[model samples]
Target: MKRDKDALTLTRRIGVFGGTFDPIHIGHLVAAQNAMHAAALDQVLFVVANQPWQKEGTREVTDPKLRLLVVSQVLRTIPGLEPSDIEIQRGGLSYSIDTLNELRASHPNDELFLVVGADAASQMPTWERAEELSTLARLVIVNRYGYPTISSILDFDQPILAEMPWLDISSTDLRERVRDHRPLQFLLPETAIEAIELYQLYRNRENG
Candidate 1:
């Protein structure tokens, strides 16, 4: 895809994949790659949430820096995957509409694509400024295993729902496996798993 070059050259087709990435895993990578290909995006930015408003009672993420590190490590192998600190730098409850708006402002001529899971797409209407968000960017909802039907989401008007390779993996399951001292060899990329082990995340640690 050719980027639009004006006074300042700007990549016109960019995909924004926002997630908590408590521990970046293969599932996240697969979805992003699939969305990029399906949407013909020039680049995909992985926006790690600084504060996920949706996961309110889900225990404040282990550590944002650690999560960012894991994301960086996982994205290292992917050519077009770019790790962005936009949400983290903003420092507040991360909202999709706000992030998309910020990105749109940064690249005035570019077409923004917001990548999301089918489950998220199903409940998008309830999110803050859902209508405005829909207008700001084209939503690319990746169909995950066991996701609800797309028709249920009234907010997504003529949204792009792409069928990607299904990988039954999730951060929640990964965290549980870690907490239980179970093996997580194949759940995530080797680098991501190594980073988790190095940081001793999820494992009960003594602190003074």
Candidate 2:
């Protein structure tokens, strides 16, 4: 697929993949890559959330700097994977609507696609400024474990939803496996797993 150019003459067929990315893992990369190919995206921006409203005060995330470093390292091996600090620099409750709006302003002529897991997609109606968000970009939902009815959540004709293969792996599961001293050889990207072990993250947190 040919990439659309931005006002600055840069490639602009970008896909936005936002998440805590407390520790970037294989599952996250898999979904992003799959969506990139399936949607014919030229670039995929991995937006690491500084603070996620969904897990507000309930979960402890690794420092944004560390998270950003890990994300950068993980994406270094994957072509077309770019790490974005939009949410981290904004600092506060990171809302999808706000991020999409910012992207729209930055790339006015480019088309934006938001990639999210099925569980989050199922709860789109309850999101802040959800209706406005639907108009901001197309939502590409990836099926994950525990969220089987993703197709039923589309109440509007906007925010086109496309289904992809289900990836059962999750950061929560990776954390638990680490805490239990279990092997995570295939569960996450080698670089990501190395970073997790080096940082010793998610060892004390309970499974989500």
User: How big is the RMSD of model 1?
Assistant: 3.0
Minimum summed lDDT over a 10-residue window in model 2 is located at 1-10
Q: Which candidate ranks first by TM-score, i.e. highest?
A: 1
Q: Against the hidden true structure, what lDDT does model 1 obtain?
A: 0.82
RMSD of each: 3.0, 2.9
Q: Write the per-residue lDDT of candidate 1 for residues 1-208, one digit (tens) a residue.
A: 5545554555568999998988888788889888888888889999998888988775757667778888998888789999988999998888988899999988878889888888888778888888788678887888865655463355546667777766888787888888888889878899988898898887883211
Give TM per candidate: 0.89, 0.86
lDDT of 2 by residue, 1-208 (tens): 3445444454557799999886677778888877787667888999988888988888677788789988998998789999999998899988888999999999877778888777778778888888786687777777654556465455544443555556677787777888899998977788888888788777877747
Candidate 1 total steric clashes: 0
lDDT against true structure, model 2: 0.79
